[model samples]
Target: MDNLQLIKSQQSKYDEIIEYLKQDNSYWLDNDIWNVEDKVFGEVEYKISAKNIRFDFIKNEVLKNEVKFYLVYSLKNKYLRLSKVLNEHQFAIKYVVEYVSKCLLNKTSFNEIHIDNNKWKLFLINNGISLNKNNQIHNTTYRGICSEISSFIRDFYDDREETEKDIWYSKNIKGAKIPATGVHGVNGHINFMSIPIYYRNTVKKYFKNIITKKSWNHCHQIISHLNYFFTKFYSNGYTDGFIENLLRNDIENYLYWLGNDYKDKNPTYRCKFVSYVRTFLEYIQMAQYDKAPKKEVSFLIFQDDIPKRELNKDEVKKVKFVPEPILKQLDNNIMDLDRPQYIPIYILLRETGWRGTDILNLRYDNCLDPIWNNKEQKYNYYLCGEITKTGIAELKIPIRDKVAEMVQKSIDKAKDLSTEENNPKKYLFNTYEGKLKGKPLNKQSLLNTIKRLIEQKDIRDVNDELYHFRLHSLRHTRAKEYVEQGMGISIIQQILGHQSLQMTVHYATVTENTLYEKWKNTENLDLFRVNTETSRLEQVDLNSDDGENLIRYEYVKKNLDAVRVPFGVCFKPSKLPCKQQMNHCLTCASFCTTVENIPEYEEEIDHVKKQIEVSERCGRELWAEKNKAYLRLLKATLERVREQKIVHKNGKSREEV
Candidate 1:
């Protein structure tokens, strides 16, 4: 059975008990040795067409019947051969059978699995795990088996008992997996049953409300934070669970302990951990439970409690973006992308700036939309998807013609491989065949594909270091594009699906085009010192920042233009008030410009041209002429910056001066 077939099912057989459950369907366990021989004889050789799996251990008639039904349901639904099903997928079905038999001996049934069952735990003891043996089964092998069984137990309640419990699985919720609520990603089993009973009942109710609205990963993260709190409480000799009554002093002590314990790590970790705990505490306290904490949890946690990144003035908050050269390399090698379908994903990511999950899980047919652009006299495309993270749904942002065409190809390919019923969600990117068939493309798989392509294509940064692409950076890069084009901050916020204006401001303002661009125009590039008295410019000692000798390189790089002004540096002392008009400082003798202003200078020229157009439209001849003159000055300054021949307000080269 081991060598005859390729065992491709990544899921634990225990999970199959939940996911492939068909309780109502017809099948009964009458015989001990359930003979399931594969009739899968095709051109695909080496696939086992015959194998006998045993299930004689089940003495109980009822439990055996249900187990058989579960297996039958799994076989019918999953694209697995009988050999693959019985194959040792880390002790696959055989181990599950052992555990099931043990449960019956312990007086447990399939319908009722107790959390306190120690015999089941004994099968997974740390020393080494297997039934009736010590150190026979390797730790890795059995641990995985335990995880699968654990998943099965957790999801069993989800699939079999959705209507019976307060908590509901996301798949069971209507519109949960729809594009409107974001991609319904992998359904990982969550074990609320494992929590201490004192906490379990309350937490289950809390989770029920959240599970319907939020994601499985978010729920998992919340539970982990809760588990940390529970472990800490029990270790500290506080046996009272979710209903524990505590004084304000006790709350303060807990906060103190949390911060003190994690003081050495990144403050953000402590901040987020505390933040998640606070959310749970507030929920319990606000719910008006009789045994809830005496202290107001919301009041206990303050605005200052969560840490903010305290960066020095010289600190460069790294803004990641795929460089233009790297982006070009990716585009050129798009054909060579490991999964050809993923090429559209990359293009949509680069073009629409949607998150990878949304793009990958798009409903193939309904994702692309067209609107007639009367001015252009053709159709403009928009990529439609939801932003579940920020609670925005069914957002349709514009895309380029080329991106739309690439997406169309992906949809066509998806249609060819699987039908709307086969791939129920009709995802544009999905596995062609396997147990994971019709499921959304794995994000990890996409990452691996990108990694392999980078190595094969020798995708490197400006300094020839191999550039590992950050997928999230594409979102930042697109925001930069929006900002560079002068899109309103609010508009960009909506497009990026940022809930807060502050979040949008951060993305829009940082706008460091890319590290490559920064490397080109900035980096350890150069610093210029201008003699204040003589107005003669020359390269300075970067190592020394003594007044009149050099300027601090870090200070200069961090602040885009000296003092954050658009036109460039001003020689005037900080205390002095400039008599010159706003932006007219460019023409003033006190203003000093440099190569650092090259990009801004170019942008200013474009702005002036637009100003000229508006002025002309209004028939304001004098205003139009003034804009034209400003445009001329901007172009002249741009030429000097490009040539590296910048000589400030005096308009003389250093040699001439």
Candidate 2:
């Protein structure tokens, strides 16, 4: 056994495949053919009338047997995704089988029938399967065919040495790279040979460090970035290692080439690629490792290196969400979703605005947290889940009772189907049947299912075009709704699991009407004016809207430049320029501020103190004195601003203060 290549499974493909099909007879339609019934598929759009999906095209008996074995196995286990509506999958399998039969004949068993990768390529090419990026459906079909054939050959056959030779594989790892939605994408495969042999050690060390601090998903992206980097690095035929001196021309040329190559990709893709390279360069130098670039982070990469994507008003509204009308249409037709497990997932996405991945990652045991409300005598519901993106290991955000109820239902459904091997995490949206048994529903499957619904139902947006939406658009729509509802920015920040307020701000796109209404209905403003003749501050009642107050309001708008200031607005008319410096406005008798500006006053004090220290350090004696006097004036004004709100509210006059 040790002499032979390490056995992933000792049982032959026929041993179990025949057992599952012939013995059980559940997956088999006849002795040889099979049926992928309605229950076998998810994301199905139309009526599934697929029957008699025959595999008799294979001329060789053993090869025919092998084909049935793998197909039935995959069907029973629910592993690889088949064609939509289960028709294309049939065609794919049939074509592959017919091609194999025509190419190789007279095989007693698949053990005797060894087909190399070149033959497989030739067979795919003959069927019009292309490596070109144009047709995603065709590409996906290609991926499925290769996956089924490669996996079947590798898993069942005794040709471990031969199979491993063709595609990269290790002893324990079943296969390398994940199945791409298209044939071209990869999850995690770092070809070290792609890096120059001399510089390979440095990148490997960077990866080792990365693995400890980041997920394999991140590593995959970095590997892609480096793949391009070293490809250019090698093509240049440079004598020195990996931007060793961080030459400006070298970095700029690679970036220029990268921009042209990745122009079609999301703008951030180029940014991430360059940023990742910078990180690698920094990591090597920081550790004093071999071939360290030793350059400052900004020296090689500037903020402007990555182009910013700023959508216009109409574009923002267009791309940021799927309109509610289309959403409601989707909601109504959600039960028609091909994956029944995904119904609740879709609802959660629409209602809660959580990322689809997080919704799918919801656990069965502890997903619903109901808090008892004493006054209302009801349990406030929270959907408990891990938000891995922001490193929120376990977060429970408020959910309406309906969302909670739906989550509980999904949890109940998941519990009935969970097995230790398939769903150790007990993901609520899990497959109980087929090759995906116990696995969380693929995120792509969720998206593809929705796409099927949109196309099938012909859901159109307000613009009267076919509606297309990304899953994350649901989250954005939800955030925008929250902001429009006047939900606090801080609360929205927490609900969306945003790492910073800046990200939350991006979602706070209020409609012009809402902004106007909010501005107009403000009943309180501690607005004040200056009695120019008397040189005293006089508070005005803005809500009164009397002739005097209206004139005062207009005056403030037209003269005072009173909309806002560093701490407060200048009560003195703009036409009369103050003799004092702008920063010294707080000391002016015309400075009128509200209680809300207290924090601003304190922050400015801190700023002034720091400046005073800097002035003293530079031996600017008179300048320091001037700052000290300004500091005194600032404190006095802060006190007066407080006194105006506090004392004036208590019915005190200016003389009393």
Candidate 3:
């Protein structure tokens, strides 16, 4: 069968069970059952048969007695149908045992009888009730009694073996199980059995005026009352806009109505009314395809507003440089408390630029020594932990020199604090040794401590919101300093451990002082000149102080053409003729005439002069100057060689020697 058919079949079986209980009251008396005396029993009577169950308003004679009683059986007896209870005289007879047990508990007179092995076993207890072998008496004071019963029934049915005939021909399966009690309901739906046991009785007691009349009547009246309230508040003139269109307006009106009109009612009573309305609406929607009003309506009903604020630069600076006086005042109060455990945390907040969450949760192992240039260097404090709100965000900041020294000192102090007995994971900033509480500071407590410091400083002005200087603002301050120092955006992003460049950019605040300095430095000409001259002098010392002095000078001057030199000679040779001639070389077609007529060294003179002319015109100042000196030396040497050659050619050199 489909799901609805299955549910209907189960409902019919429950109807049969109720009937069986009513019919065989004698069976219950024989069973020796007793309902709790103080609890209110359902006054509404039920009539049942094999096929149908119905309600009756008739007041039974037995129910009108001074000490009225009802049968209480474990829900595990699911095979006993209401039809059998209503029709079977055996079941009616069992009510005597139930009644007698209740009377005896209250010290009243009542009689009971039970059948054991086809023999009547008369029970004579305190008030004329007798306990039998098969009958189990449950004292109401036992903890989780209902839950245990429900569990027993569920297990009983779950273990039952099914036969083909039982599945195919039986009207309903015997010992049909209810859901598991408490949170784990059967079929993951609402537990009907448990619901009536707990919520129904409480609901009845609270809404006594409404529920005492009739079940369906009470349910309908409450539903209608809620419908009316919702309709008036949410509906517009054209359509009863209760289902979909009603939102904030409906919620506000409902809250006002409850607080004002129900002022005399207990707060719980008003709450139950609201809860009932919500549950009823949900049930109607689930069971009968009715729609609920928009969710925004309910959400807007009890809204709260909180103010948002951000810290400015001056306030941020105050947080950074918390004065010794303020710390001293805090120390005076916290001296009886542990202050040393917290000081390192404060120092880390200022130095490493970690947030409150990160700083509070820092561990000793998180401070790792980073390898600088593949060598063991000083420790780099890396915050290796999950962020409070976002999981697993690691921040690596180079420990500043002073901060590193402070951390080392803190570590030494921590070693003294850490006895052989303590667990190091407890916390670096814990006042005590091992536990999180009393010793190590908690997150909220740390925030409050910082806030207290801000107050004691008396630094807040009329407009200043001191509490805005959260630990996060310290990180922002560090990032802003780096940005002001002309650090690249991407580098700052890495330092702050931000996933996005945009987030890093938000921390970058350029101040007027930085802008003014940049403009002044860029515009100062004299300063630029001094720097240039110093650089040139360093170059001169590097090149000219060796055996390769002239060669180095030529090399240095060649490079120095592009460089600005404040105090240095620059030789620019004028296009005067070879100084031996009166005209520029280019204007003199007679330029080679002087060299050509010196026939003894004519060829060498021509070659040397050509090299000089070429080097000078090309702006090779150093090369041209060097070549001029070499040319004069070469001409003199060549003349001496020519004179010796002439002497040797005339045979006079032998006699002269």
Candidate 4:
């Protein structure tokens, strides 16, 4: 027999099994027929039936206007009993019928469907009946026992019109070209088998040898619980309901139980459960096509009404102090020969206000001069280093005076302990005992040492962890001090190398007491309380170049520069060069005559020149035109003084004071 005859013979046997299932009263019958209305094959009907004993089948119209039938028997039931079967066989039957419909009407191939159906038929023959040499099913010598029944159904029922030849031909051709289902070759199959086996064994070995036995046992217990649930509740003998129930109702209850009951007993259990659930979901995702559920299950929990700790003034003062003896001990220990070389590290933290990580990673090369130093102090050292976690370029911090002195002292001490050819390229805190020799101190080691010191000094009442006392706290304290002293926020930010003002603000703590004290000390009471009616004078333009002015602009400029007057002072020079040149009015013999000659311009010129000179010499850059204008004003005042002197001499010789 050819392929068509064998297919027909197999269909007959499947129909017989369907009849047998229908006759049994214990099994449920569902004659769910899917109908399709097509332009070519009008009213195509596909019928599916399932029984509880593991037998299910589908009947659909074939290409030649004949009814094609297929059946499946579950392997779990040895006696071909359909009642004990799951929904898998029924689902498979539906897939096959749908696949055949697609092939006939949509002109598509169903390779997986075809392979599955073939396996089901083979399974049936191997377990229930036998096939002859010609590949035709035979039951008690009959070639096709259910052929008459199939013919009757086809003749009386199934009134669908035949699909067109072109459509049928396209579908058949497409179906024939379907790809293979299994591994490509023997090597592929071997590799596929070997990889999974190797992975399984390796995982088992790791769990057995590497992980704690208790952990391994716990995982096994969980898996056993899942397996027990699968055997008892799942219709398909799989842990399907366990996952469904976990998603539907148990998750919240489990979290609650963890929070209330197991919160302290097994603090990590809730987190572990969440992790396990995720792992299971991921496994399912890889094995099947289903979405994982999303829910909030936090790992941390705390009492709802917790209060923050705040220190009062006296308590703060007590915490801030280091006893005289303790300070002396620390100083001596820092200078000691046998103790750990942590003095430099501690001093650095106290001085530069750098974090532990920053200090640990500090290079000798980074301690150079700053780009802008108005004081012109050569002892100033700039700290340029990297932030540990972020790995970004941090700002350079300037260390001068006390801080620079401490750093240099530490460097000298470190170098003295080393051999003669000591290079400054070496870390300022290099030692024999620490990691990264010729480099800075280790952050953790430094933290540990400080923590020990704090403990020894009994100062760790609030914060016991030395690591928690960040190196950045030094920076914060310094910033607070600067802010309290009336330093500009921008300057503090530059010193701290903070990119944002907001961050600098966090470190800065302003107090009203400090502000009041500053106000009391610096503000001038006389200036503020002056009576305008008595003290006010006529406003004079300092930019004026009046020649008759007794106070020369040059004299005022020289006096202002000599006194090193602050910006914003007010004064002007004499209009003419005195007979006693370069001499002040207090020492000049011709002072009285000059003063009497140009007394009107004296006060104005004095005030204006002083103001102009001081304004030019302010901390900020001075404009060239402003400086030149002030110089001309001074020269014009000198000329005015000279003209007045000559006029006075021509008029009369006045009496002495």
Per-model C-alpha RMSD: 13.0, 14.9, 28.7, 30.4
**lDDT of all predictions, in order shown?**
0.61, 0.64, 0.42, 0.41
From the highest lDDT down, the ranking of the candidates is 2, 1, 3, 4
Estimate, for each residue in 1-657, the C-alpha lDDT of model 4 and write its tens digit: 597975676466445545544532413233233212312112223432542322224333232122222222111112112321233433333433444454335522121122333443454365455676757644421222222222323322222321211011111222121111101111110011111221323223322332232222243434333333223334333343244224434544444544554354443333444444444444444444233223322222122211222344454454232323344444455434233567666776655555565566554545444455567744446666654322335557776566666666665666566542443345555544321234445555565666666555554323443223444555666666577545688887766656688767766764455557546433422223334788854433434554224235344443332322223323333343333223233233443445454554455456555544444433211332344444454456556567766333334455432
Q: TM-score: which is higher, 1 or 2?
A: 1
Report the C-alpha displacement of residue 76, candidate 4, in angstroms.
Answer: 57
| Per-residue accuracy of model 2 over 1-657 as CA lDDT, tens digit each | 673533334344455655655645344524555554545433444455666567666556655666666565554444433444165666776766665567755544544444554666667777677765643334566545644464455445545432232222222233222221111213323335456667866777666565534534555677777878888766777665546777777788888888888877766456777778877777777898857876775677777776664544555556576566777898799899876766877888877778777777778898888899898998899888776556666777888877787778777877877888777757777766654566577887788988988888899887787787699888888887787654789998888877899888887675555567556434223366678999999877645766466766545433312323344334554356545644555544555567888898798788667556644543445445655766777788779877766323334465477
On TM-score, the candidate that comes out on top is 1
Q: Which 10 residues in a row give candidate 2 its minimum summed lDDT?
A: 176-185
Reference-based lDDT, residue 651, model 1: 63
Per-candidate TM vs. native? Answer: 0.61, 0.56, 0.30, 0.30
- The Cα error of candidate 3 at residue 610, in Å, is 51
Q: Using lDDT as the measure, name the better of candidate 1 and candidate 3.
A: 1
Better of 2 and 3 by TM-score: 2
> TM-score of predicted model 4?
0.30
